[model samples]
Target: MKIYKYILIGFLIVTTIFVSNHGGNVSYALFYLAIILPIISVIYTLYVYQHFRIYQMIDHKTIVKGELVPYRFTVSNEYFITYRSIQLKFYDDKSQVVGGDTTVEYTLLPGESIEKKTNLRCNYRGEYEVGIKMVVITDFLRLISITFPIQSKYRVMVLPRVLNLSRLRILPLEKDAKRTLTCNNPEQIEMDNELRNYVYGDSLKRIHWKASAKKQTMQTRKMTQNPRQEMNLYIDLCKLDVTGMDQIIIEDKMIEAELAIVKYCQKMGVPINVFYQQDGPQKRRILNAMDFNKLYQESPKIKFNQKVSVHELLSKNVINMGKCLVLVHKLEDALCIQLQRLKQNRAELVLLYFTSELEEEEKVKIGTLRSIGIYVREILREEELVNIL
Candidate 1:
């Protein structure tokens, strides 16, 4: 664009000087042509800008991290003017566009269209938008280029990748711990249809919304409780110690470990229920065959909140604590005490702490937790996940 502008300016200056110094028909004619050419180019560019259309499409709206998604774009010329030196710019630093140039350059003749497909690899897990940043349209002489703003956009949801942990074995509970887990004599199938105000750990499906509306408060139904102890997975995403990039890495690892455990339990046909913290409040969700999409949608919502600790999150528990599997990014004394209390209540527990580096103090804390009845593991990398979990 700069080169074309400089050439046009130099041509105009030379032509005007020649016509002024040497007054002749040939010089005058050249000056007029030089002036008319740019005018024509500008007019042609404006016309093409009005007639050109851009369309963007994606193969999938949601994909897991590390997966390549196909993105297709179509540029159409609806008018009689031919377009050359055209470029499509859609580069953004947040995402990686592979298999093609960031700015696609091509020519579109009158009443013609061109389509190009490229693969987009999303490294992070979250919601993202993929759209054309800008369209560069140039004239036949390449003297003028007009950039048109694109209003069309598409949304892509990148979910966390579930690791293949086929050979991974969950650490077994002790004989006494297993007995305690099985000895809870709650009826296998008893329906307690009692309506009460909504609590943190209540199932969303059992919400008595009609009563809630009438009473001007959220109400939930207390259903029959299962006697058999299912796996209780607790995810604590509070980030009070780490900051900046370190905090980000911790969050990612936490998600990876949590999802890996969830996927493993699902594959092995283990009855499991997830209790996680969101916005400083405890939330519960029972995993089932139909909850994959819901899980994906909610996983991104797990983020750092206030200065919350795992112990504080667990202290807000409303349901009976059973065989507990705790996933946390950081550990504190309050959390350790809570784990001790949980074990004292005859609950079988396993703790997986995801951290990149372990300090001396942290190692000592891990040792202390293991000294108790709690099965503890430090997950440093994805490869160690199988043996550690």
Candidate 2:
């Protein structure tokens, strides 16, 4: 609060009353003026405090990116008077506090609530805290002031934006359409309702909000497993590969290869099982009837969070994918040996090894895997992926 305004007003009033009464006629008018100034200021301050307090309420506890989210804030006052210049402030988790302050002005009556709403666009993905940082309310006479809390905070979750690209080729190598998935099918089993913790690429639908709020941590959501016939997606990331000129190039290739596999499985109308080597064994997660756009984006982040080895993934979970398809970065003898073993043991699968470094190796592994009952083919050049098989 600005004490100078009150002091100045009191001084001016006292000077005027004392001068007028002493020089001309009113007797002890200054004494009456002094009595009234304190009362008026006290009342004004209390009125301002009661009327200008702001409270913000957020509707969405957590939200996914690219979804329209809403928020409401209520401004209250003590008396039935309208405030003219009261302004509200806004802030979000990814604080780009370079603006000249965005504010909205409104009026309110005593015990009245003035609510305001606005939509937030999903720009960047991650966890976010959004709400009022500080609110400032002032008097028309330029006399008083007050500041609100430092952290007016609310929680929100923003996920990555996904674009639909299933039309593009480089899909999974398949012959007949597979239909092993049925919604809430008996193939699924209820695991644990208790959420553990949240991983980066977890589906937004799997989030357990009640547990998250209670624990105040990003909990891994666990739900009943569906009876989805698992299909394998082996991204041909040959360890003994060549040309590391651009990591981005290699990463893009891997992403495209994985996308092709996923799109193929999705096109076949079959449920897919995705795995990437993390800190431990290949972390397995099921993508059951997921949106095509979402599947496209999630395929790459798996590598960002884990260094996946195709051989290890196959050795561990090949039997689960049913008839599996492998995308190899190069035609290494080690991978060829593994494919031969898989096919020989009745683990009928397809292997497509694509080498940006060696186009010839793409079909090498395919031929080898097919020799032992596994249907396999090579996706050598980028153009071959776009062809209608």
Candidate 3:
């Protein structure tokens, strides 16, 4: 096409010279038509793009890291001009298209619509963008091409996969001498009890309407006592420079180990308390096996580069002096210091340390954690997840 266009243009130039020299009307008319053809082609290309519509759809909004997510791209031409060369280009650093083709080409006539389907996969855990990033349109003569950027955005959460482990064990601390009263049912608590500031995990039904009306703030009925010792799941979401694929694997392993422990605790009918962070103060949630989906849905919302650390979370006096599982992606000196403090409080600590490749220094640190009577286990492989928890 380029060769033909150049030949015609050259002929038009020669014809113009011939008409200027010999004054022939035929040559003058040919030159004028040649000049107008390219102008029309450019105008047509621009018009086709202006009227094109694009829409995107995805099959699943939440998917595991290793699973394939299906997406559909719909492009339609609403103008009278036919698009000879149309391409839809989309790309994201966080995800990869399954077939390795980020651009899809098509030929569309007037009022024609086309739909292209593809699959996407992401290795890391977080919310990833998936939509039309740009579009490329060109004329049939290959004279020029135009690219239009589309801001249409869609987000899909990539959740970490968990290992289904069997034969897991959790050694709890010695039972306390005092037990909770038999009338300690949560639902049976009187609504007219003491009022306190509303917390995230508090049930809305326990809201104190009278106090809220007087104080101009939401308040929840405070429970007198929480007798059952709850199991704690502490996940470390501190920011890390994850530049290598190995580091990503370590992150996934850390999440997997956490899930395995949660599953085991839920199976044993234990009341669990979850603690983690994302760019703010650490958040806490108390749940049981029946609320497992809540944990699954909330894990992917952790944004990268958050400042919360495992040491800051564990050092706080929030956790009860009972059994706790600490899932960490990295082992730091400060974290070890906090782990030692749990021993003085008589809190049973189990550490699942995830690493891609361990160094001698890390091994020695793990030994130090173990020396403090904290059960420490290294999770380097996917298979180790079965027993590490």
Candidate 4:
């Protein structure tokens, strides 16, 4: 109710009393006065609350990058029946409007509602909330107005883009696959595996109490194995020096290649020794996306044809794997010589290379590798794997 309703009722009552008490022409005057005042008050009160709504909304609670999110907003009048020129604004964490701004000119019949919807895409990572700072509603004459806060914005967490390797992306093999090898059971060996020693996530049965006391660090239980041939998986992930293409694009390519090889071998039942050339010590297990926390200690330098020393350490493996797969990065002369020597001992060797920028020299070299039975292949692009296989 507006002030006019209250004032109109008060005047009507007072006029009735005065007209009855005076009992004359003034009664007629009172009747006219009561009518005029109430009408005026009704008009003024309706004018005050006419334009009245703002709303912000999102279709879902979560979204991933490169995907679309549907946004919906609604505006309506509570009491004053009037038209509204409405605008919906959406903002991100940085308080910047991102994509969902809209305007509509419509009238709200008494107790009526109107809604609008739009689609939005987010290319960046992190949680974003969509909000409207203010909503304005007005009367048909554009003289009356009201402002209200939208109920609230919805929060959406956008996950990072997934890496998809389409073709010949090369990744180095984990420790060399030797002629005959077995991954020893964990219970038999005795050593700490991950550095930070042990944390809450590790199993209690594997705790190295002695080491924990001595080093004053959590010691994770590690199995002592006759060290198997460890294959260092070196990736040339750096693309900064190369101009023109975006870093994230290159990262995507490399990530795709890495995941494909990991998934492929995992499916094939091969036990790999994995490592990033930028870091020291190799990870012997095939990693999944959730295993990112393990890479915290790893820092690898990206190079065009990065080399790791796992091939050189093959002779020390107590267990043999029967073969070695070096993918993505090129084999150095020393590593090639070692591979050749190992091949004579019944171990198979495969060398894979890829690029949109391979030179003639590299191309010819790949042919020479085939002549030596190194099983070398080059892919022009990720999608070209169809022809290679």
For all candidates in order, the CA lDDT equals 0.72, 0.55, 0.71, 0.51
Q: After superposition, how far is residue 29 of candidate 1 from its true place, in Å?
A: 8.4
Residue-level lDDT of model 3, residues 1-389, one tens digit each, is 56867887798889788888887778878888878878987897878777888888888888788788787778887778677777767665667665645455688888999877878777678776765677788788777677888756777888887666554544533354122112224323345577889999988888888889999999999775443556777888775545566666666676766676666556544566777776566545545555766777776775435577877888885356477788877788888888888788888788877666678999999998778788887777454555644
Where is model 1 poorest over a 10-residue stretch in terms of lDDT? 178-187
Ranking by TM-score: 3, 1, 2, 4
TM value for model 3:
0.66
Model 2 spans with C-alpha error above 4 angstroms: 1-59, 78-84, 92-101, 107-109, 139-147, 150-152, 168-264, 267-273, 276-282, 290-389
Residue 48, model 2: Cα distance from true site in angstroms:
5.3
Candidate number that wins on TM-score, 2 or 3: 3
Candidate 4 off by > 4 Å: 1-233, 238-241, 246-250, 279-284, 287-321, 329-346, 382-389
Residue 311 in candidate 1, Cα distance off native in Å: 2.8
* Clashing residue pairs, backbone N/CA/C < 3 A, model 3: none
Q: For model 1, what is the alpha-carbon lDDT of residue 259?
A: 77
Query: Candidate 2 residues 75-109, lDDT tens each?
Result: 77756665655666666434222331456555565
lDDT of 2: 0.55
Please estimate how well model 1 matches the true structure, expressed as its whole-model Cα lDDT: 0.72
lDDT ranking, best first:
1, 3, 2, 4
| Superposition TM-score, candidate 4 onto the true structure | 0.39
State how far residue 384 of model 3 sits from its true place (Å). 7.7
Off by over 4 Å in 3: 1-42, 68-70, 96-104, 117-124, 169-229, 244-253, 279-287, 318-320, 344-346, 355-357, 371-373, 379-389
Q: Please give the clash total of every predicted structure, in order.
A: 0, 13, 0, 25
